[model samples]
Target: MSAVIDIEELRSQFLDQEFDSQEFVLKTENILTVARASGETRAEFSDESHPDFQAPPALLCSLASGRHLPIDFPAMGGIPMDGGKAVTRHAPVRPNQTLIGKTHLHDIYDKKGRSGRMILIVARMEVYDTDDNHLATADSRMVIREKPTS
Candidate 1:
């Protein structure tokens, strides 16, 4: 199998490049929903006007951060897989506040496995607040598997 795009070119075009930051407002309803679904009894996650209303830890990176992808993936005609994500929280994420974050292509490469040629693209995102205080970083990896030819 052959790569759909030049691997090196993809890296040069995306890696370490910062994109425009996007704002994600932590709605009260969403926070409450997640807290209830997670079987959490803490009022911080559901109480919008509470002074301690904080976002659920697991929801920090759940704001569709991929919407800020720095680069667009070409049609590779391959199956895509969510390789998972790693997040390092630097501060508490709260609700009823606008959060700003941007995503960048952190790394990209290709590999050959028993299934076929696989391409891995990793994206890194930094979340912050209106004051520009860093809150967390999440790295999400996506894998593309080459399509089988008849």
Candidate 2:
């Protein structure tokens, strides 16, 4: 197995890094239709009077926060492909709602691999409403494989 990764060190690289969190302000005109067969109800994603309603869950996770790029993978000695779990919050998102997403390194660990070593990078993604209230949080995991060069 490879050496464990230092999440603190990785997070420091993103410290003071500011990103525009305003891109989530989606216009009603931008709303897309969800197939009826998808079982999305009007009360769940849209209103009967207006077909152009936004889903809060979708808006919360709309964009990849800038912090995603800087995460370090100990096995690769650099950033790995962005991977995360899909999380949904119970709160309803309304149109013209603004959201901010922040990402931080959560943990890192290693496991033995058949060929060499495998490393896992875990990150926490938090989304907040305009009021700074936490809307949802997700634990994203990235896996890196370290194979010896022949």
Compute each candidate's TM-score over C-alphas.
Answer: 0.79, 0.59
Lowest summed lDDT across 10 adjacent residues in model 2 is found at 14-23
Candidate 2: misplaced stretches above 4 Å? Answer: 1-23, 27-42, 46-59, 65-79, 88-90
For residues 1-150, write the lDDT of model 2, one tens digit per residue: 344454456566643443323336555444334324345566546553464445545444544434443534233554465555556574555557786667665666667767666656665666678788876765566766654544
Badly placed stretches (over 4 Å) of model 1 are: 1-5, 41-51, 68-73, 148-150
Alpha-carbon shift of residue 104 in model 1 (angstroms): 0.4
* Candidate 1: pairs in clash: none
Model 1 residue 12 distance off true place after TM-score fit, in angstroms: 2.3
Q: How does residue 148 of candidate 2 score in lDDT?
A: 50
**8-79 per-residue lDDT for model 1 (tens digits):** 987887788887567888777888899899998887776777787888876875753455345465667766
TM-score of 1: 0.79
Q: Give the alpha-carbon lDDT of every model.
A: 0.77, 0.55
